[model samples]
Target chain A: MRLADLGERSGVPLATVKYYLREGLLPPGRRVNATQAEYDESHLRRLRLVRAMIQVGRIPVATVREVLAHVDDDSLGLTVRLGAALWALPHPAGEAPGAPAEAAGPSREAADDPHRAAADLLVDELLARLGWSAARELGALSPAHRALVATLATLHRLGYPLDADDLLPYARTMEQAAAHDLDRMEQLPTPREQTEYAVASAALFEPVLLNLRRLAQCEESNRRYGL
Target chain B: MRLADLGERSGVPLATVKYYLREGLLPPGRRVNATQAEYDESHLRRLRLVRAMIQVGRIPVATVREVLAHVDDDSLGLTVRLGAALWALPHPAGEAPGAPAEAAGPSREAADDPHRAAADLLVDELLARLGWSAARELGALSPAHRALVATLATLHRLGYPLDADDLLPYARTMEQAAAHDLDRMEQLPTPREQTEYAVASAALFEPVLLNLRRLAQCEESNRRYGL
Candidate 1:
């Protein structure tokens, strides 16, 4: 099919399709002539995936390019590609050393560096692993991706000596909170209600994070003042 | 009082302090002389708040600037400012229309757009309100935040129609699923174990979403083949 037909089928505008092509997000269509190019089912699939990453994931084009490169690699699994995209979202704390190795496990050693170079690498690796894991499972969900990235970036900028190990505690906290949150969601007693609950729960996740932080802040304040 | 002293007191490096000032994230200290600026408790408080917004809230500088501006406005409650900052993280789902009339109310007549623009706005507002209430109660737990945002973004991209009337069912579902997930988490004994469970759960949320999608896909496939 021609570009117009492909656009019509995808329900995306022609201009947006052209922009995707120029951005190298879409692969070149079969050239029928100097001015015309044809698309196929693969193009449709790729376009959908691209839209998913951009609209849902809210990923920047440069990062999307990197993710696409990883995705297109035959050697890498879907999980790994997803991880790369997640990792590309933002810098995390304790990222200067052998973070990835530590995140992946003992197979990789933490090398000593006077400048904490090993620590930086470790942080980077750990984030990559976490990103990959999150992406594989949660590619359909973009807000979570943005929230995590934003949180990580904030922590990084704050000079917090964070690593995957430190993050483990926070991650655990979030998981428990989510579990509790999800439990409350299941009481609705209908399939439609269940789906609605999923959507609502997902929407509420950020504010829940904020409220939890307030709780943590209260706890911190109590500890600080010996209240 | 000097930059070095302030750095030591805040545990922030002098260079980083300079960077913060340059980024407009921090105000310059009082100029004691041509070569030195004196810092004080207010600076310390501001710095900490900045750090929290950056790290915990994951707000960007531009958004942070807006937040700071709003925070300085005494008329706005701190909770309101905080909520606004959190809301700002997710890119606008297009311009928000008028405030929603009420939760669980009937859909309003959408204006010119046949796609029910008013209804969509009403639903988004309702969801936002639901999120705000949850945040006030639950605290900002990262996993929940990510889950909710991702789900909303996905639905938005999928062109799901929503309205205020849709909220009650959605919330009811979340309350159920969250409860179910939490009950499983509590089976693990000890706070530390609970913490570990939380981390694992964070890792697991993605898988849950993926599995749900997989189930849906499988059901669709089975129906197609009469399996």
Candidate 2:
């Protein structure tokens, strides 16, 4: 098929198709003449894959080009290249703050920036502290801790700055205060209801953080005014 | 407060602080003279917010600058600007192809990029198809639709190359096959076990997509060899 035909079939514009060709994101079609080129099913497949990486993965064009280059290299597995590229892209979900069990295994460093490295360490410290606090207060491997650990692991890799050390001290302090908060939140008396409350609380962690920040600011202002 | 002091407080290094200053992600403090500068708590807060935006939000420096500018504009409500900035960043959770309830209400043309507009339409179509499939098979307000909608909204705003008319048919086909596959997997007669399976399935969506590409390639080669 010619460029127009390919564009029609792919539902992309001819100009955009030409741009992709120029960018080397799309391979050159067989030349029929100075004004014409023939594309095939492989072109269609490649186009779809490019669209998926760009649209679904939200990868930058430069990075996408590098990924395509790596995938086309016969020495590398396309699957591995694709996975690495996908991993490099920012996740669509909100960032979590700790590494998950699946991510705990040996993996190549996805980033080399020193700031990111420092941030990762901080997140690790926060998780450790949270783990310790849970063990001390709730008797070890509490369902909340388990859930948080899993969530954190996923977020940590995705690049959330949550140092376990900094967070541990803060979490310990919050844990002590939060018990009272939880008691107030759950006016019900059953263990099952409490478990549900715990689940809901886990989901509301960000909002709780926001509220805490506001309260702390208010308290500081009150103290300044001798209120 | 020297560079080292700022570094220690922020958990970022002197070198990284220098980098942030160069990138305009951090402002320089009052000069203690030509060779040194003094830092303060405001710098510490800014550094932490920068780290959060870059590491957790995965926002590029240009986008981060825009957010920072908005945040610093005192006329704007801090909470509203922060929420908008967060909304603009890619979500860390994987795309929720199953969660339609999370979908943004209606589409608006904000930017003038034709490709972006087309991509938004495509995402909407994909989500609509996914929603229809989930309603038909899994019942109303399915988790999968909610997840997909949330993911699609983020992907759409990020200028992915999806066009609604192009992806709708493909999504419908994929949803049909996925529904069949999931039905077979759920045939193991235990209601309590189904919840566990659903949770596992939700977590493995990305891995499954990764493997599906591999499976398709393998099948293609097998067919070529008459296997």
Candidate 3:
């Protein structure tokens, strides 16, 4: 297939495909002649994935490149690839990734940023309670860990107290979701595909969970406050 | 407290506090003299909430204005206030809110956007399965409804298969979250405070849930593919 057809079949515009290729986000096609090139199924898949990362995941192109690197690196183990993929995305309003490993006094984040210090403590307690090995190994390097820390810190900063007991339900139920998500990913034939599924789930299905939570919150409010 | 104190305590800058007042994101402080005004505890809380909506929620100022309007309207019932608050947040990529209520072929969203149409069906199925009252009343007008529809549409457009069964666990677990959230809100003394809590939850706590899911997904991957 030609570049135009690859763009059309993937539902990305021609100029955008050219931009991606120029930016090294997409690989070069097979040269068909002096003026044209042919793309295959893998090119089509890559184009769609890039578009979703940018448009749906709302990840910057640079971060998309970082995440794709993890997906494409076959030397990494399956769990490791998925861990790196999750780590690759940016954490919103959290302490910078790979920062503040030392848990004691005078750490820059602890000294300069109390929210992060408090968040770190909460994340430590949550992980300790759950005893998840991947997150334990990845620790502060994982964007997921930082994001959780940051959010808990946000709630606390706003005067909403969230103890480990308050968060146990969320942690336990998310384990169920994680198990379901992994059960599906493990059934896939390739390790790369499994990592891809994890990445896609992060972008695509998360909104589903969030919206459902919002919808259910409406129900609970009605049950409590209808008069 | 004076305007300066309000700004200092909220950690919002004096200029930004003035901007909020100018933009009507904050109410006018009590006029103490020709040049200055006094603020109160409510002003402090409102300032914090507005800052959280903008900084933590990443909501645009215009949408914050819209949501604040709902929170300030005491004439509305408690559940009604929550429903309106949820409705006021932006749906990332769904159909225009308040569009395509008919569910018939001639609706503009149905005619023009198959994703919105497909999303409508999925939301209907999920709501019917749960039989939630507020969502049932609000229907397509709700931002939660539109966001769910939009996200499902995104997954489908990206060629991911998500059945109602795939989404059931998310909906059910979110009900547990919603119940916990609402129980907390119900204990607050004021209806207005309850709505404020709902708005805050939508912004602040959602990240915690999402990151936990990501952390758990890593654990699942490790359990299966550790080598």
- Candidate 2: residue A220 Cα off by (Å): 30
DockQ of each: 0.08, 0.04, 0.51
User: Which regions of candidate 2 fall more than 4 Å away from where they truly are?
Assistant: A31-35, A51-62, A74-227, B1-227
In terms of lDDT, the poorest run of 10 residues in model 2 chain A is A203-212
1 or 3: which has the higher DockQ?
A: 3
**lDDT-sorted candidate list, best first:** 3, 1, 2
TM-score for each candidate, following the candidate numbering: 0.44, 0.33, 0.86
The lDDT for every candidate, in the order shown, is 0.44, 0.43, 0.76
Of the two candidates 2 and 3, the one with more favorable DockQ, higher being better, is: 3
> Interface Cα RMSD per model, in Å?
11.4, 19.6, 3.3
Candidate 2's residue-wise lDDT over A1-227, tens digit each? 88788788775568877888999999999999998789997687566555545544455788768656655555434233333333333323323233223233222232543433443344345544444332333221222222333334443432333344323433443443344334433464643333323322222222222222222222222222222
**TM-score per candidate for chain A alone:** 0.43, 0.41, 0.84
C-alpha displacement of A51 in model 1, angstroms? 4.3
Docking class of 3: medium
Summarize candidate 1's per-residue lDDT along B27-125 as a digit string, tens digits: 788888898788886677556555555534445678666645544445543334333333333222221123122111222333434444443454346
Question: In model 1, what is the error at residue A21, expressed in angstroms?
Answer: 5.0
Model 2 Cα lDDT, one tens digit per residue, B129-165: 5454323332213323333434444344332322454
lDDT of 3 by residue, B26-62 (tens): 9998998899888998898888888877876778999
